[model samples]
Target: MAHSSTASDKDPLYLEAHDDDDERRNLCGTFWKRLGFVGVAVVIGVVSVLGLSIGLGLGLGLRHRDHVKFTTPAIVTVPLQSSPPSNFVLNGLKGQPPQTRVYAFNVSNALGAPDGVVRPMLVVNGMFPGPTIEANQGDRIIINVTNNMDVPTSIHWHGLFQNQTNFYDGTSGITECGIPPGQFLVYKFGRFLTFTFGEFSGTTWWHAPHESYRCAHTFTDYSTQYADGITGALIVHPSEPSPPDFPTWDQDLVVQMNDWYHTFSSQLSAAYLSPFGIDGTAGDEPVPESGTLNGLGQYGQGGNYFNFTLEPNKTYRLRLINSGSFASIRFSIDNHPLTVIEAEGTLVKPYTVSGVTIAVAQRYSVLIHTNQTVQQDGTFWMRANIQTDMFTYVVWGQNTDVRGILRYSTAPNLAAVPVAADDPGPGMSWVGDMDTSLLVPAVVDSPPERTRMYLVVVALENTADGRFLAFMNRTSWEPLSGTTSLLLVREAGLERHNATSFAPVGGSLQDGDQFYVTEDSIQVVDLLINNLDDGDHPFHLHGFRPWV
Candidate 1:
């Protein structure tokens, strides 16, 4: 949502560090803290910082136990298909015991031209956008990621609750030391739902996943690495039909969209982070040169449009993921109304809309009945347009309207050019949509009867040297060098540090971006986010689902 506030807070059991202004007072009541920042800000209310160390130890123990040994499977060589097959559904997986899947990925540099202009990009297993990780709920997924590139990197399993396997979170500096260049790290975790009603059932993703690091372009690097390529879809099927009777689809297809940048991610980050932001404008995020659907788009240079062929009359579930580094996308198809069913990972009551405006790192699964009569050309334009207004400055030749083809099997001319439909005008977006009540969670898991509320402000600030920096109240997050906070704290022992705060933990709060909790009991928190900045920023919790 643009220029509006949202109330979404993470689970209190697993709290990330952030600075707070209050002390241990009123152990049984609600509290509010005012924090301001320019970009995205995390509102964390910690009752016990010791959980971080405990979680990390549990995760490490799970991976290194003498009894648990993993035999690496052969890495798939073929380029990952853009969408899953028609038969990829959960019905077949029911009644089977959970199985473990092991995968190995080689992270390296390569040249790709999704828009017909080749550029150096980071890739997994020699492919852009990596590979899809498909698994049913409750399956253990062990991935061995080897760094073949010159730089060290880590892969954050976005949205997957690490639970007891917190060390496998893949967050560099916070959870574990990054996989150094030429070295590999094994990420072992289970794909389990966090809530009663299949909380993490639908579409999710995995990316470079960085919280703030010390480098100027590190923020961009988080965006850049994934933007360059290392992004992929992660589909977790529900053990049973979510909400018991929610309708199922005949075909499950993934439509991954991203705003494409021709320039190197590092250069773009440097310019955006620099004092003179791209033409003297401070804090202007680098606008993408083009947008891509399923990693392909016909833009300035020339490229193939992602095509989706379907059998008529069958209900298809389109797992839409906005894996772009920046820029929220508005997705729709000509003459097709999308019936929204899932947001991020939570399944919602079916609501139909012309289009869906998906923010970065957000996912939505919508069902579309392919009942449209076969047209002359057999095709309808699938549009994944980037919201240009979200950008501070406009690029002259930028192609915001990224299109693909949705062809029916009964069309007369499969080769004929498809006619574009009239403008849909800015359709319904989760953020800007007026009818917020329409997309209610299928199962309403109410928050605790008594909860703590925190007020946080988000804004951008210009440093003395001219660099633009984001802050929440008094501090900005910068990663601890050499070792991760979790590892450092675990090695130093939780007994040495106060359970409530990281202040006594040396080098943990030097950046002053994190806060801690002194209590051990489970507590509910309400994080009220007020976006003071100009654009629509998306905030994500690495390991837990936030009740909105």
Candidate 2:
């Protein structure tokens, strides 16, 4: 992985995905290790499920997606890895001077440890949890992504309107081919964007959007990718002279929370996707081994933590991001009430909350005031605890709660305040839930009458080689290969050589496979999503933010 700046040629390599043998080997090993019996008793149990039909490659009521080999035009050279540029631009979006911003990210395993535990994690610019990209609404943003790993990679700016740059949407094989190993790719934004909100910036995130049940979280091709790392927060500022709606705040804090695991994601995915469990029962999605706030936490302990310093009587706006792989967490600061200001990217009518429930991949901005006298010695605990017993996974996470500190003192990385003195504050009762129907959108929710309506049922079925497969309207999303569905349609006239040039395979079939929709004319689509799964799943529709 030597550093070079230029790349040419469409590099395509077949990913050496784990085979049945490799998968079974992991299943045999992990199930034993997970049970804490690496000795004789565990070995016998591992051998029992080795005869599963999953490895035989027979679909058990689930339609298997055909793998497509995709190719990209350019590859990036692995210039020597370096720290993030210290002087990156930050625009308030109220009326920024610069119209363009540049960002360089080296997708590599070389970086400081997240969770303070050195594991096989992918990072951006050598930063775990990645770096935040703060820019004005109208500014052009260019991101140079260099893939230094053995596998290909891609990045998706979730919730952002790609507008004219659909290829830059970053859904591998669907929008664009991935950046190959030792190669680089550039994603450019704002080419076709007309920001009506003047310099608008909103809270969004960038992560690996090439969704494979295996490697969906991380932008890499491998299954265990995101579990290792490769996610970050992005804040878009509207204009330089930002709208003066802010009554005011002294400081702004970005608080990101997630569930962590010691085991590789692939291992857990293998089990979660497998039809049979390690002990010859229905498979269960592996629970997180722990939780982290801004990439710092340990099992059942506040190892490295998210610490906040506040001057007395000052109001600080906290941007809360639920970056968990899969978990809805309740976020709250003890002895403080949160004033909800923004939901997603839209500013909401300010509302008070004792604790807010954050679903995965969701973002919120709340205002916290330092009104209370510091309890338990000038400190309070900021809690992001997983809502257990709500989700129906057979297994449970090792650590249920992750706590950080809210200190009145101005210090970076001070020794932890004594937990013995930690008071959760006359624990306020968080009853029921937030009323979403009552919450109003900052922008008017107006659209042409829905022309096409779809009732999508989200469920997990005992199919796909005997594994628990997630589906939408019985259609689960699997990556497409060769040409992207986008490219196929946009460039439909480019190639009429094949009779089925733009046709989606098995798309017309029912009950569990990827579905392709193509409307020759622009049509408003109303999707009525019915969540059949016992657990609540966060639904995010890319390309457009529809009124819910």
Candidate 3:
């Protein structure tokens, strides 16, 4: 893929994304491998407006959302660990110069079982459910990711606006080519070079933790690294003190929940993309054998459960992120109500509920008061149940409820704890189940008057060749071989174009796939996403949090 330079090539912004000779070779296989697994259909598109752009894409599976009202139930909360992991402790940001935080990520292959089934896994810094990346609003975050795996890989800073550093967006072939096997890439967000939290601070995550590690170089796409471990919690605290109206807690905790599979993602992807389904059910996504809370759960044989020790009569803020590749999870504790304060980083008026349902790639911040009396065994079950009803088919004896122990500091013997009798099955109504959309943001701003609009209709297409693919309108997104849309846009140079003239910007737009480039300018655009699939889809925008 030869890059044709235009007059604007010397511009500073374009220079920032320019690649060297070696990188050009790596970029060829980068995106194609990252997104190669066509097993699950995903649609990605970019719409530029207001000098910013929105990168929208569909999550794992379409979800069926049940609308529930906000409730103010009597609730309690608590955090994990005797003290916050030193790495994740939030330092004061007020009256201090911003600091640069560095994390060394060594992405490699390992073997571990989150749910008792040992399998090949991808790990970061030798830890499954990788270390927490905690930073204050304005602090710089520099993660030098070294790919020690045999395959190429990339990391996406999900939900973070890359601002001027679009190359660090970490979508192979889209932003910049992925790092090659045994190579390294420095992802800098925060400070002036790449990103600054600015006014935004909230719960968001990276895939594989950007777990879409490009697994195989074969024609099929495989990005199951996150599923086979390699994901973690990323917490960005508000630099300013909690507003007087915001919910407060004595301690903060992080819990990352996800569906677990015993098999490697590559194998599962191969089965999923096979013309014949796993068990004669074509187009049925692979059902997970179990679920995990903070990367620990159990199956028939052996596995450890995550435990959160709490002090009595204390309020805590629990940050929850669903980093799974699939499966919508219903999270709850035995005898406590969760008071929702934040949804995907937006502070909201306190809304209480017994349990909250979160889909893959979604996040929530809830405060619980640990005021409940200790159980007889001094342990409560923190249940993360897979909404198995959403699956197209069911596997026998598949345990959907993944439980963790919530023990109090006063418990006489932690080893004597028993599972809660009332821990229910999938789809069973946990008391006070609430829909996140119903919660209102603490501060609401009206969108500017729209000057343009795009309607993207999403649906599952059963192609003539007997394969199920997801499409946005008439096009399904396949990466441009060996190059990225951003690269092409840079080569061609940026120019303003109105809605009527908008067209694909990269190489020849293939008949079944498409990618577009938008000028970095102002245009208030309203995007309407219509999902025609029976299931639900969680759409995520990389750099913008749109008002839904």
Candidate 4:
């Protein structure tokens, strides 16, 4: 009634002070209490601010944990194999049980000499290009890999697909995480059915893809801690016991082609970057005493030198695998003619050629008649001719070297050798005549299903900064950076017209453009030549096996 102003009508500053006073009084009562309240408020504000700052710092710290500066000590393990595992034979066609066995292997680096020549690396079964696993088409195959190294390792069944039974696919992330060091992984295949014809009949291989890493052409040594030396071949033969017109045998021979590294800078650079250098600074160094057949380095050297005794007139099947990192081989006997019956593991028409060019990831089954009129010294020289281009490292510019020897006869008198029986070895033999039966064109029983095309272009770049760059399919392989996955996606997304962008901007085309795609259930890969050598590319496909 006296018109006294309400608390809301009081001066703003006075009202604010009054509210603060009320708050202080509510928090406490006496003068000492008010001071205590003010102190408590200040403490609360400080605590809140400190808590927020700490929480934000912790979040940022967690987000950057992977970026923390920390050098990981290099972990090296020298792989060892107590003994070579027993080879398996394909006996299913002969009504016999399929041969299966377990193999143990180690992966480690081979320390080089003190002269800066030897570089440590990851190897398999104590050898670069691990042991060869041989079996016939109808045989049940089981491979037990024990990773004794300090990192995770996996085996990819290149060119072989498990189809519905995807469990047998050896891809690290797609099928399994692979076997970590000190662990064993069992990869089983061929238990379901036998391959009648097509892709399964040819040469196939296995290698470690421990995660995504650079391959030959992109990186100097090819990425992956184990790629420099840890690779191998898997040859699956036809169910038929005899290889066409060839004679059978008690034992088989596996020739592994490979390249060895010595310089830490060269090896490490190649392993993590490009194998080919701009001028001559990076890539494979000439291994003075490397290169082996069955883990045996040079002939007559400490490496595995093959010395097999052949009956004067008996025939032997040579199962050859071109497992070299970047070498192409021209294999022929000194004075004997060689017959090629299969290529890439598939049965081709038995054709006699002067010499077969074995590129990377290629397999050939041939019948070498030790039947040469026996001379006291009839030596069949197996040589691997290196094929390089302008892009090839000058360090590897040398002529062919003798791979191994095929001693015709051990008899004192070379001429008195008897003709051996033509019985197909202990394995299953094909029912019909290989020449006529395999040639009869069979009718198409099913209509084709799906189709896709892939254009393969090799990219080469000689930068102004003296840097050389090379790539397959126009995409430069980024070593260990794990950028290939993204590049592959971008490649797959481009339209036909946009495909040109895939090639290197200013690089030359070592190999021309070629497209590979599946059509109507059949996968068709066409290799188009632009500037590539007349040489063939032992192109290996993963997931699905091709018949060509």
* Residues forming the 10-long window of minimal summed lDDT in candidate 1: 1-10
lDDT (C-alpha, whole model) for all candidates: 0.58, 0.53, 0.60, 0.39
Poorest 10 consecutive residues by lDDT, candidate 3: 1-10
By descending TM-score, how would the candidates be arranged?
3, 1, 2, 4
Query: Per-residue CA lDDT of candidate 1, range 143-237, in tens?
Result: 77777778767888877655445556566556655665667766655334121112356688888743434322232234246767787778888
Off by over 4 Å in 1: 1-96, 190-199, 211-223, 421-437, 488-508, 511-519
**Weakest 10 consecutive residues of candidate 4 by summed lDDT:** 45-54
> Using lDDT as the measure, which candidate wins?
3
- Candidate 2 local lDDT, 387-444, one digit each (tens): 6543333333255667776766532334445353343542346632355555565555
For candidate 2, the 10 contiguous residues with the lowest summed lDDT are 41-50
Strongest candidate by TM-score: 3
Q: How does model 4 score by TM-score? A: 0.57
Residue 311 lDDT in candidate 4: 59
What's the lDDT for residue 142 in model 2? 71
Candidate 4 residue lDDT tens string, 277-320 = 32234422122223444333332212223334455565555666
Q: Model 1: what TM-score?
A: 0.77
State in Å the error of residue 67, model 2. 35
